[model samples]
Target: MNMMGSLVALLVALIWKPDFEEWRLGWDIKLFARIFSGIVISGMAFAVIVWCVDANGPVFVSMFRPVRLVVVVIVASLILQEPIYSGSIIGTVILVGGLYLVLWAKKKEMKSMSNPVETNRTDRNVV
Candidate 1:
C-alpha cells in the first residue's frame, strides 16, 4: 500500500508541478521536503507495523486500525469544531464491536491450534 501511495505521489508530482513561488517556498526544496518527509514517516510507520506484527499476530495488530476513525472524530470535533452526529456514534460502536469480534475469533483460533489431536494409529513409524 505504501508503495502504491508512493507511486501515485510520484505521478502527481510529475503531472502537476505547482508554482511554489507564490507560497514563498522554492519548488525543488518543497518537493524534496515532501518526498523526504513522506519517506521518513512511512518508513517509521512500516517499522512499527512490522514490530507489532512480530510481537502480536497480524489480526491483533490490525484490530487497532479502526480506532483511527475514532481519533479522527475527536480531532475534528476539537480542532475543526465539527459536531459529532449520531452516524459517528453508530460507526464508532460498530467499529468497536467488529474489533471485539476479531479479537475473540483470534483467541479461539489460537486455542484450537495449540491443542493437538490424539490418534490411535501409533504403530509403525518410529523416529
Candidate 2:
C-alpha cells in the first residue's frame, strides 16, 4: 500500500513537471550514507517480519502492529518534546486491551485443543 501510493505520487509528479533535475540532489556523503542506512535497516526489518510471518501465522504476527503505536507515543513525548494527547492515550489503551484479548483467546484455544473432549457427558450431567 505504501509503495503503491509512493509510485502513484511519482507518476503524478512526472506528468505535472517532468524534470530530471529534481532527482539530482548534490551528492553529499552524509545524505548517501543516511539513505543507504535506511534501506539496509528497512530491508532487514522486512526480512525479519517475513520470517516471523512464515514461522507464525499472520494473525499471531499482526498483533504486534499496535506495539509500534505505544513506542511512538513514548518517543514523541520524550524525544520530540511533544505533549501527550488524549487520543494517543486512548489508542494505547485500546491496543493493549486488544493484545490481551488476542493472547487470552489464543491461550484458551490451545488449552481446549490440548485436552481431549469427553463424549461421555452422562457423568458430567450429574454435577
Candidate 3:
C-alpha cells in the first residue's frame, strides 16, 4: 500500500514538474540530513502503526490519530517555540473528551462480551 501510494505520488510529481533542473539536489549536508531522517522516521512510524493495529485492532489505533495532532501541537510549541492559540487548546480538549468516551465504551463492550448474560425461554408442547 505504501509503495503504491509513493509510486503514484512520484508519477504525479514528475508529470506536474517536468523540469528536471527543479529536482536537482545540491551537495548540502542539511538537505541530505532532512531527507534521510524523514524517510527513517516515516518508515518507523508506519511499522509501529501497523503493529499496533494488528495487535489492538483498528479502533484502538484510530483513537490515537487525533491524539497525534495534540502531541504535534504540544511538541511544536515546546521545541519550535510555536505559539499555541485558543483554538488549539479547545480542539485538544474536545479530542481528549471524545477519546475518553470511546475508551469507556470499548471497555464496557469488552466486559459485556467476556461475561455474557444468560437468556431464558419457555417451550410449549402441542396437545
Give the best candidate by lDDT.
Answer: 3
lDDT of every model, 2 decimals: 0.86, 0.87, 0.91
Model 2: lDDT equals 0.87
TM-score of each prediction: 0.65, 0.70, 0.68
**Residue-level lDDT tens digits of model 3 in 1-127:** 8799989989998999989998887889978887988899889988998999898778888898899899999999999999999999999999999999998998899899999898876667756
Clashing pairs in 3: none
Error of 3 at 118 (Å): 2.8
lDDT of 1 by residue, 16-70 (tens): 8666554365668888888887799879988999999998778767789999999
lDDT string for model 2 (33-83, tens) is: 879877998899889889988986677778998899899999989999999
Clashes of 2: 0
Candidate 3: C-alpha lDDT? 0.91
RMSD of each: 5.6, 5.2, 5.2
Worst 10 residues of 1 by lDDT: 17-26
Candidate whose TM-score is highest? 2
Which ranking of candidates, highest lDDT first? 3, 2, 1
Segments of candidate 2 deviating more than 4 angstroms? 8-23, 121-127
Question: Candidates 1 and 2: which is better by TM-score?
Answer: 2
Indicate the worst ten consecutive residues by lDDT in candidate 3: 118-127
